[model samples]
Target: MIRPDIRTDWTMEEARAIHALPFADLMHRAQTLHRAHFDPNTIETASLLSIKTGGCPEDCGYCSQSAFHDTGVKATKLMETEEVLAAAQRAKASGAQRFCMGAAWRSPKDRDMDKLCDMVRGVSDLGLETCMTLGMLSPEQVARLKAAGLDFYNHNIDTSPD
Candidate 1:
């Protein structure tokens, strides 16, 4: 059995120990842990709403919306608050436990951030959890979103800043 006290953020030696374990052993341990904490038959589902489409400025080569790439995706303006609310309602009706809103940009503008805050507030009122992936948000922006009842934020670290 895997150690119940195992920390998710592993130390170097702990990571090495895990990596040295056989694949079957790892899977068995993971299965045992999962069954202990959650029902084996339970599978949670959620939906994503692309609240804002395209027009990103980053040079992330893997990103289709990067300004430097010719990925054939069209740029669109930020979505209105009502549009995002409607999508969130649809997600909730479809039995989603969470609804995630996403915008394509390197960073959100002040106006866009305000709109996002409003959207988050609206979604929260519907009793559904709301999350966002509006690219890189500053500390102040994150605090503002949290104040507006933002449940989660997705900020991807593209790579080691090497």
Candidate 2:
């Protein structure tokens, strides 16, 4: 069994050993580790709602939504509060434990921020946990979202510090 907290970079010798292992053997080992850490009967599920789509100013190479890419995805305005609430209810009915709202933009605008707070309240009313990934947010914006009952915020550090 692999150590749960080990983060050492494996040398080529270790890499070769792992490669020599059978696929099913590796899967079984991973399954055993996961079951040890979490309940076997626990159903883990999450759903994403694209509240705002496309039109970002960043030049992130991997993202199609970046201003540098011509991925043909049109920039869209933020969805209405009622629309977002309906989606959240559907996610809950589909057995999702959490509903994540994602917006494609550099940072949320004033109107987007207001809509986000309303969305959070709507999601909370459905008894599902709420999370947001709305790009880089100011401390004040963070506090505002928290006040609206947002459970978590995801800020992606897209690349290494180097």
Candidate 3:
């Protein structure tokens, strides 16, 4: 059986040994752990909406939304609060337990924070979990989001420090 204790330090050899375990044994262990912590038959549904698309300043090569890439995606201004709320309502009606909003900005502008907060509150009021991926956010912004009832925030980190 896999160890139950949480661990932060693991040697490369130890990790390699675990990776070398028999496929069937690995699957059994994984399934057992999953069933222990969660309902095996239950599924959580989520919907993702791009509230603001394209025109990102960052030159992340892998991202199609970056202005530096010619990915054929046109830049659009931020959506109106009413429109966002309407989308959230639709998401809830379609049986999504979680609604996620994404923007193409490297980071949201201070002025736009108010609008974002409004969107979060609106979505949360619909009894659906709210999440956002608005790139990097300052501490104050995070605090404001928490106050607005945001459930999760997603920020992707580069694989290498290039």
Candidate 4:
């Protein structure tokens, strides 16, 4: 049964109070909530593949793929549609319910949007939910992605960061 106290929004003070709780206490609270709302015995898996690896111009300290960092990751062009589909196949075979494509970019260039959309379509055709995290996107770009039937568009609060 759904909890009667469930809410769609929380006040700042309520959020802060949760954040201020002791680590163990907070974890316990979260676990209790999860147990109440989710089936504890069920687990789902996802696979994240870097569709475009490295060469990001932004220098976010937390990222290893940034051009500013010497993480020894060489920049590469975007993976081909076939390559991405193969990875999605592997993921599905390994029991992943969703396939997430990630790119190390400040934002995908207009020239790259077509290829990105093709990748999303190919992955979705494989019977897996398609997701992408290609930095920032313009309104037009988002429309193209939506037209291609993208299931999710994951973005970070900080550009080019996790």
Per-prediction TM-score to the true structure, in the order listed: 0.82, 0.75, 0.84, 0.86
- Give model 2's TM-score versus the native structure: 0.75
Candidates in order have lDDT scores of 0.87, 0.89, 0.94, 0.92
Tens-digit lDDT string for candidate 1 (1-162): 778786667798988898999999999999999999899999777789887777788888898877788889888888899988998888889998788988889888876778889999999999888889988888889989999999988878788557
Instruction: Provide the lowest-lDDT 10-residue window in model 4.
Output: 153-162
lDDT per residue for candidate 4 within 21-40, as digits (tens), equals 99999889888989998997
* Superposed model 2: Cα runs more than 4 Å off: 1-37
The digit string of per-residue lDDT tens for model 3 on 104-126 reads 99899999999999999999999
Model 4 has an lDDT value of 0.92
TM-score (C-alpha) between model 4 and the true structure: 0.86
List model 2 lDDT by residue over 50-96, tens digit each: 99888888888889877678998888888999999999999999999
The lDDT-based order of candidates, best leading, equals 3, 4, 2, 1
User: How does model 1 fare in lDDT?
Assistant: 0.87
Q: By TM-score, who's the top model here? A: 4
Instruction: After the best TM-score superposition of candidate 2, give how far the Cα of residue 40 lies from its true spot, in angstroms.
Output: 3.7
Q: Which candidate is the best by lDDT?
A: 3
